[model samples]
Target: MSAGKGLFVSFEGIDGSGKSTQARLLAEALRADGREVVLTREPGGSPGAEEIRALVLQGDPERWSAETELLLFTAARRDHLERTIQPALACGATVICDRFADSTRMYQGLSRGDLRRAVDTLHDLMIGVEPDLTILIDMDPAAALSRAKARATAEERFEDFGIGLQEKMRAGFLALAEEFATRFAVIDGNRAPEAVAEDVLAALKARA
Candidate 1:
């Protein structure tokens, strides 16, 4: 199932679910074991994609409609795949992505509208690759939202949608884990970061 010699792993969850921290932890662990790790993020993994990221993540929630967001995200992802993800995997480096298409599936596909079909079609047509393994950090929407708001980053557009969006996203992500069960490892994110990292590492080892 690996697209290349290296393993491709993606972390997915609602905002503030600690998936990003876990992605970094796993990358460090892999490197400590002598594996070459390429840790990156969606919507901004490559130069062009990063430019798109600013547009999509910094504006008002209503700035871009769900349909527009879908197109923008897909474009960023295409660039990310071509300039960052594929090349890393082709060279036998473990590619640890913070967020991948599943985020699009939940946010753009189900958030404002039922654009799942469009998301899938574009994915198949422009970006056919899937992560060899996906780690989903699961947690309560309320708690996760609080953590997310605490960050107060410029990319708070998504967070601005409030707990309602987080609630919906959490449920959608859980459903997604079931839909893609074969490649997913659902880990609880309610514990301390180190504890969560332990589970994340364990999931990776289990997948291996």
Candidate 2:
């Protein structure tokens, strides 16, 4: 779909790199700066997407094959874009989303190598939008995994993949950032939340 006038920023990283927290902080910071900001997340940003989120995130890890899970994620993303993200941008609101399509690429592509082609193809065919800027919170997988497990939520399907998979996911994200250098900012996430937030803002300012 076509992009709207406002800025679209997405936060991505391994499961517990604190990307979500950073997204929230960035949104608050931007709003305080007098910008209209919309804070949202993927897999459940909008009403219809939230339903899909439950089916994907709350079930057993084996509930769907890699390809099947990719389709489900694409469907939820379609709804999320149409209902929440696109509309907010159309209205000139900066949209800060936690976990956009990159999560799908890293998780599905790295987990099931063959599905990487399918992920890219389906994304181009059905969801042809990319974030204006993507903030990758790069960090150590072991530390991130510890944080993820400590949260102990029902949506632990991805987190249950353990430290090894998290390591792979981290590498995938870094590779993605390299591939899309113009639209990505890789931030060191092994720091205090406030420090990370400051770095994030600095990165955005530099980009601007």
Candidate 3:
């Protein structure tokens, strides 16, 4: 919503809820309509951020304490904003991010209730940017965990937390959407990808 700047859209949901796929589909659809779009993801977008991504996502999930993880994520986000996101928006390109600050809020804050204030405070002070629109792909945790497990990757630290954590994450995301209704579009992600993509497009058009 920056003055005359391009649209900023972010996808958020529990792992394997297909938010990443939906974000890509939306970007493709926008480009088909002749809109300039930039597709990116958090924890890694710019060069410096990607390096940080490796540090945070690889190895043991307990490699960093909750506070340390938050700091790393914040640092990466700052770098991404400075090097990638801001530049794209300045040039009037719709930037579609796979995840944003909402993920940090849900993962870090909801995981430990007391940390919510810290996350918001750090965000306000260091990373004040918020997406113009955030698409939350809601899905059952069991299904999402299945989908997430099917994809084998070295960066499985987040997924390693297992089903219980994913269920908590789903609830956290839903609560967040309700809290920020004006900027959120909640989409059912239990259906087929094509169907979900159609719904996502419809929601974006409605907002537009």
Candidate 4:
């Protein structure tokens, strides 16, 4: 870890678990505190990564196999790190990412199959960057799905995995968080947005 490096914080959850909102609030709060902040999301940050993110979330992913999807995510992460995250961190700008390596591990590694192998492969293949902190906005899978459906946005292939599978994905994320307790903050996402934002701010304050 670079002691002089910018703080690397990741916000993770199912599609409608309020992660993005919390990340935004936290970024704004960090800025208000006179800290430089870079707020970005995974699967996309730079132009090229945005294209890849679109491919992963909005396209006919049936064109690609599960193995292919995992590899592509890792590729996107590598570019994101090399081109965006690394430089910002080197300059000491705290980076608050909407999602990061853990998302892939939950969506693909645990939900899909071969969890252990996927973790190993991604670590070996990517630049091996992990977040300094990961906040998991925890909520019931059914509630999260309902919120997601209300948004009426284009669904990612992962979101279409059905409620049953999504429940498993939730469990997967929780288990993964458990494995890295020191780096995780599991907050109740079912709460009001302002309350949730406060929770996120508290976590950031603790870390900061």
Model 3, C-alpha of 103: deviation from truth (Å): 0.4
RMSD of 3: 1.1
- Candidate 3 global lDDT: 0.91
Residue-level lDDT of model 4, residues 33-61, one tens digit each, is: 89999999988987778878887887563
In candidate 2, where is summed lDDT lowest over 10 consecutive residues?
109-118
Which residue segments of model 2 deviate by more than 4 Å?
A: none
What tens digits encode model 1's per-residue C-alpha lDDT throughout 1-208? 5577889999999999999999999999999999999999988999999999999999788899999999999999999999999898889899999999999999999998999999999999999999999999999999999999899899999999999999999999999999999999999999999999998888888887
lDDT of candidates 1 onward, in order: 0.93, 0.90, 0.91, 0.83
Q: Give the per-residue lDDT of model 2 (tens digit) for 5-26.
A: 9888899999899999999999
Candidate 1, poorest ten consecutive residues by summed lDDT: 1-10
Indicate the TM-score of model 4.
Answer: 0.93
- On lDDT, the leading prediction is 1
- TM-score for each candidate, following the candidate numbering: 0.98, 0.97, 0.97, 0.93
lDDT of 3 at 105: 98
Q: Counting only residues 3 or more apart in sequence or on different chains, how many pairs clash (N, Cα, C under 3 Å) in candidate 2?
A: 0
lDDT for residue 55 in candidate 2, whole number 0-100:
89
For candidate 1, the per-residue lDDT at 171 reads: 93
